[model samples]
Every structure is written in C-alpha cells, then in structure tokens.
Target: MADPILSVRDLVTYFRPEEGVVRAVDGASFDLYPGGTLGIVGESGCGKSVTARSILRIVDRPGEVESGEILLRRDDGGIVDLAKIDPRRREMRAIRGGDIGYVFQEPMSSLSAFYTIGNQLMEAVRLHRAVTTKEARQRAVELLQLVGIPRPEQRVDAYSFELSGGLRQRVMIALALAAEPRILIADEPTTALDVTTQAQILDLIRRIQDERRLAVILITHDMGVIAEMADTVAVMYLGKVVESGPVDAIFHAPRHPYTQALLRSIPSVLAEPRSRLATIAGSIPHPYARPEGCPFHPRCARSIAGVCDRTVPVVTKLDERHEVRCVLYGRPAEAAE
Candidate 1:
C-alpha cells in the first residue's frame, strides 16, 4: 500500500470566544492515503469541518490550531508540518489551494454573487498555474464540463445564483479542481440538494477522485454517503474521533458505544415502513461547556459509572486497521487492576 499523503496526529483546534475556550477539534488523528477516500462522520458541531480547515490552515478568526502536526508529504519527497507554518505565508497559500483543494459546505455563500462562474474558476487556475487569461478561461470551461455542468460555454459566464442548487454544487467542485490539487477536502458536499442531485454529486466526486487519483477527505454526517464512497471511516463525537477503521469493520463490528448508536440510528430498508428510527440519546454538549472525561459518555449506553465520566480513554487498537477510543474496550488487566 502507498504511504499516506496526509497524516494528522493529536490535532487540537480551539475557538476562544469571549465566554470561554471551545475545543472544536480535540486530539483528533487520522491519515489519508494517496487516491483513497477517508470519511469523517459525526453530527453537527463535532469538529468534522474544523479538522479539514485546520489542515488547510484556514480556521476562521479566534479558532487556532493549538497543538498538532499536520504532516503533508510534498511532491519533492519532503514533509511539511502545515500547523506550524505561517498561514499568511505564500507557501501555505500555495498548499491550501495548490496541493489540497477545499470544497466548502455551502456553495451559495462560498461563491461570490458579484463574479461570474468563469471569473471565479479562472482565478483559481491563474493562481495555481502559469497561464494567460484566455488559457485559464478555456481550462475553466473544461472543468465545468468535467463536473457535469450543462452548457459549459454559457454556464461559465452565469452567476452562481442563476444556476440551480445542483449546478452550483457542480461549479464549486469545478472550482476546487481548477488548481488540480492532489487532495480534496469536501465538507458536507451535499447538504440541501434533493436526493437525486445528492447522489449525482457524490457520484461526480467519486468519478473525479478516480480519474484524478486524488486523496479525498469527505466530512459529513451521512453514514450512507460514507459507506458508499469511503474506504476508511472515522467517527467523531464532540471534538474527537472515537472510532476509526475500514468501512466494513466500522459498520459490521463497531466497538465503541457511540459508534454503535450512530449506526443504529441510520434508517434501514429492511425495517418496517413506519418504524421509528433508533436515535442517539441527548444532543451534543455546548462547545464552551463540553462534558468532562469522554465526550460521548453522557449518551453512551455502555458507559461505566466511575470510569467513563472521570477517566479519559486513549485510543486502543483492536487490530491493524481498527482502533477505538472508549472505556468499554479497555485492556482486561487494566480493567481488573
């Protein structure tokens, strides 16, 4: 197997509002191999988006990558710690869109209404590649066509608001690929689109990922999308990844209580038509007032009385490809002691 193109270790990102510090991404770790898809699944406010932003050194104001190493393997065989680099530096700017492209969750807000789609896409091309305006425009049209946007010639000149939700999404994808980056981080790529459009967007991403052989980090709450597009899975809670492994292992043999609960909550085709879907109890705790030890313990059914609430659990390996962070999987000797 090829080595990971990107490796994140013990990533801790925090947002300091006036009230208090919010641990947006607390000690989350994962790796993305070249040309492989890594799915980060969790409910809203679980740091799925923050993790992606941290990697690109684009955490908004007040949010900082406090401690961690975002090791990115460069094309020259050297590795750079993105977290330590100055975000304003030209090198970091190049890496953000040149080495790794990001498709924001919402295309409406992300795309400027003032600029035409061609102008936006061409800007990316001109920024990343040494090309004239005419060349860039041609490249932008090709990208739009590649993403399945109808009438690439005319649509490129249209404003984002002029296109439908699905077409806008396709343009966003085209913009992300304008730089031809080796990695793509898509945060909730299909949020408000219809079911058919959502499937089409997912399929488009998968197709592009294959054609480009790009390493992809797909962040979303939809397990169905993860199951369909991801080879590896990372289940996050609050701000940490509680369980991670191959998609099959995660779906069939989930070890963590939180992971089990999330899988159970997914509506199944085999279930009775009107049956109420299983749901994880309780909402995600407030950012400033996160739970004490294990973030998921409050809602975890198998949480130990004294153990889970007080003692934070470190990640334990269940196998070469599977790891879980939960007291329920503690070593037998450690439990006995």
Candidate 2:
C-alpha cells in the first residue's frame, strides 16, 4: 500500500475530573490509507470517539491529549503532526474543515439552531475558499445536492429542525464536505436514525468515499456496520486497541478475547429463531479503577491468572498486517513465570 494519509501512534487522552483522571484513549494507534476506511469498534466509553477528537484536536473541556503523534500527510508531500498544533490557532482552524472534515454524531446539536443551514455551510465555504458570497451560496447548494438532498436550493434555506432526521444528517454530511477535505472522520454518523435511514446514510458515505477517494475513520460499536464499510478494523477495549487487522481476519479469526466476544454477541441471520445471543463475561472496567496488567483481564475468558495480571502485554504480530495485544501470543514462559 501507498504511504498512509493519516497515522496515529501511542495516543493518550485523559480527562481530569473531581474523582480522578479518566484515560479515555490510551496508547491507541492506527493508520488510514488514502481512499481506505478504518473502522474503530468497541462498546461505549472505549475511547473510539475520543480517538477521532484527538486527531482533530477537538476534545472537550478538562480533557487533554497527553501524548500522541497524529501525523498527517500534506498535499505538498510533507508530514505534519496535528497533535502538536494548538487547537485555537488559525492554521488548526483551517485544517479542521479544509484538510480533515468531521461528521459529528448528532446533527441537531452540531448545527446551530439560530443560523440557516445554507448560512452555516456558506460560512464554511467562504472560510476555506476566498470566494464571494454568491459563489459560497452556490457552493453550498451544490454540496447539498451532492449529498442527495432533494430540491437543495429550497432546502438550503431550511433550518435543521425543519428537515427530517435523514435530511438533517444529509445536511451534516454536506457541511463536512464543504471544504473538499482529503480525510473524513465520522464519529457515529448513523446514531439515532432508523435502520433504513442508517443504511441509506452508510451507502451515501460509501459512494462519496469512492467518488472522492477520501481517507475515512469510521467509529462505531456495530460490527455489522464495520463489516459493511471498513477495509481494516481496530478493536478497542477500554482505551486501548487489543486487536487490529484486515476486516476479514478480525471477523473470521479474531485474536483478542474481547474481539471474539464482540463478534459472538452480534446477532447472526443464519442462527435459529429466538436463540439467545452470546455476551462478554463482564463490562469494561472503570477508568479510575483500571486493572493492573491488562485492562481486559477482568472480562477476558482466556486470561491467565498470574501471567495476565503480572505484566502488560506488548503487541504481537500474527502476520504482516495483523496484530494482537495479549500474553497468549507473547513469551509464554516469561508470562507464566
């Protein structure tokens, strides 16, 4: 494969609360190649969303990216570490929409109620491109049409609340593409939508990706969605990625216990009617009370008592593209001793 468009390495994001520090994203790493989709899958609070926010430097208050290297390949054949840039700087602002677009989980909250949809999109257009108001409006309308919004010219003037859930999501997607970014970060893009609308939105994203050849980082808990959209898969447990590989390898032969449990929990179409679904043994450990050796030892069925709880497991490569963080693949004698 060609050089990756974006690379995240040893990312650690923490939130300081009254209780203690919450390590939302701990040492999570992945690479997104140009025109390829990387899916980050895990249950809630596993730091999938925080990983996206860390790349964009948009983590909310009290939360800070403690350490990470978010290396982005620039158009000029240079690499820039987005993690080092100040979030409030003009350069960062420009890069947010111009170089890397974001489609947030909730459109209603993401879109301002006070501004018209066209107005907001036009502002984004004008901010990135030095165009006149007329040109910006035209661009906004064009984007709305591009996202399959019906009668975009008229719909551009509509408020977010005036549009249905699917339409509102379309508008959000349009806004994300306002600057023609090289990479798109979608954090739970199909949340709160009906199954049909979710499928439509997913299809829209896939079509747009193929048409534009944009690198995408899709974050979701749904393995089915991951199967449908991702070329590579990263399975996160707590704030760390326990396994990462091609989507087929992760689905058909998951290495990590958590990944196996997650796949087992998904409902299968070929299963007998009304059969009980499989589930993980326990929930994710609390951030403050994180386990000593491995974060997943508490819930993992294959955890070795002294070995799993004694030393942290380093990543072990099963193949050129597949890796897992578990003692089972590590130095067994050392772990056992």
Candidate 3:
C-alpha cells in the first residue's frame, strides 16, 4: 500500500465545559490512502463527527486537539502536520478547499439560505481557482450534473428550500467537488435523506470516489453504510476506537465485544420473526464519567471480572490491519501484575 494521504495518530480532542473536560475524541488513529474510503462508524455522540471536525480544524475554542498528529501528505511528497498549522493560516486556508473538501451533515446549516445554490458553488470554485465568474459558473453547472442534479443550469438559480432533500445533498457534494480536492470528508451526508435517497447518495459517493480517485473519510453510524462503502472500518465507542480492521474482518468476525454488540443490534431482514435484536445493556458512558479501566466494560457483555473495571487496556494488534482495545486480548494479565 502507498503511504497514506492522510494520517491521524493518537488524536485527542476535548471540550471544556462547566462540568469538566469532555473527551470528545480520545486517541483516535487511522490512515487513509489515496483513493481509499475509510469509514468511521459509531453511534451518535460517539465522537465520529467530532473527529472529522478536528481533522478539518473546525473545533471551536471550547474544543481543541490536545495531542497527537495530523500529517497530510502533499502532492509534491512533502508532509504537512495539520495539527501544527493554524486554521487561519494562508497555507491551511489554501489546503482546505484545494486539497481537502468537506460535505457537512446538514446541507441547510452549511448552505446559505440567502444565496442561490449556483452562487455558493461558484464562490467555492472562485475561492480556490483564479477563474472568471463565467468560467466558475460553467464549472458549477458541470459539477451539479456530475452529482446527478438534473437541470444544473436551472437548479443553480434555486434556493435551498426549493430543492428536495436529496437534491440539496447533491448540491453539497457538488460544492465539495468544486475545487477538485484530493480528499473529501463526508460527515453524515445522508442523515437527512430517505432510505432510497441515502442509498443513491452512497452510490454517488462511491462512483465519485472511483471516477476522481479521491480519498474519502465517511463519518457515519450506520453499519450497513460502512459495509457497503468502506474498504476499512473503525468502530468508535465513547470517543475511542475499540476495533479497526478491514470491513470484512470487522464485519464477519469482530474481536471486540462492543463491535459484536453493535453488529447484533443491527436489525436483519433474514432474522427470525419475533426475535429481539441483541443490544448492549448499558448506555454510552458519559464523556466525563468514562469508567476507570475499560471505557466500554460497563456495557460490554464479554467484559472480564475485575480487569475491565480496574485499568485501561492497551490496544493490541492482531494483524497488520486489525487491532482491538479490550481485556479479552490479554491486557488483563499485563495490568494485573
């Protein structure tokens, strides 16, 4: 495999509230190769979106990347540590749209209600490219079509309220691609769409990735989405990744108890009638109230007697591409003595 286009190592993001610091993203690590789609799957409030926001340096004052490195490999082979770069720096600004694009969860929130879709898209292109308004508008229309929005020329003039949810999402994708970035971060892009629309959006993302060869980081909680689109998947729980491996490995034979619980919770079409889905017994540990040893032990069915309650387990690697942080991986012995 080629060197990763984006590498996140032990990223720790926290939010300072009146009640204490909330560890929104604690020691999350992953690498995404060029043109690879890495899915960060976790339930809501598990910090999937926080991780993405941290990568983009959009964490506000109350939240920050306290530690770790975000190394991005440039086209010229130079390594840029995104953690070190100020978000407002000219270099970082240039990189935001030029090398990395982001499609936020809510198109309505990211999109301007006051501005026309065409204007927004054209603005994104003009910010990155030194093109005339005419050229940028033309490019915006082309992108709208590429993202499957019909009547690109006409739709560009419409407001956010005028378009359907799916169409708005397509516009968001179009805007993200306006700069032709090398990496695209889709942060819950299909959340507002219906099932059929969600599938279409996922397909669009996959097609876009293949056609443009863009490295994609899909931030989603839907296991089905991860199974469908991800080459690699990271299962996050309470801001930390419990298991990360190839989609097939993690899906077929999950090593971590949390991973197993998550898989069991997914409703299956082929499941027996009247069968209740297997669910994790407890709710997610509060960010500030995370358990002493294993954060997930409180809810993990396979948790060990005393070890899981006593100390944090070290992340153990089962293979080059698979790892888990669980007491079941023999961390108990090391922590005990």
25-79: candidate 2 lDDT, tens digit per residue:
9999999999999999999999999999999899998899999899999988899
Each candidate structure's TM-score, on Cα atoms with residue i matched to residue i, is 0.97, 0.97, 0.97
Scored by lDDT, model 1 comes in at: 0.91
> How far out, in Å, is residue 4 in model 3?
0.9
Please report, in order, the local distance difference test score of every candidate based on alpha carbons.
0.91, 0.92, 0.90
Global Cα RMSD, each model: 1.6, 1.5, 1.3
Candidate 1, residues 146-263, lDDT tens digits: the string is: 9988789999899999998889989998988999999999999998788999999999999999999999999999989999999999999888999999999999999999889989
The positional error of residue 143 in candidate 1, measured at the CA in angstroms, is 0.7
Candidate 2 lDDT: 0.92
Model 2 TM-score, 2 decimals: 0.97
Off by over 4 Å in 3: 332-337
Alpha-carbon deviation at 126 in model 3, angstroms? 1.1
Best of the two (2, 3) by lDDT: 2
Model 3 Cα lDDT, one tens digit per residue, 13-117? 999978799999989999999999999998889999989888888887799888889999999999999888888888888888788899988876678899999
Clashes of 3: 1
> Which of the numbered candidates is closest to the native, going by highest lDDT?
2
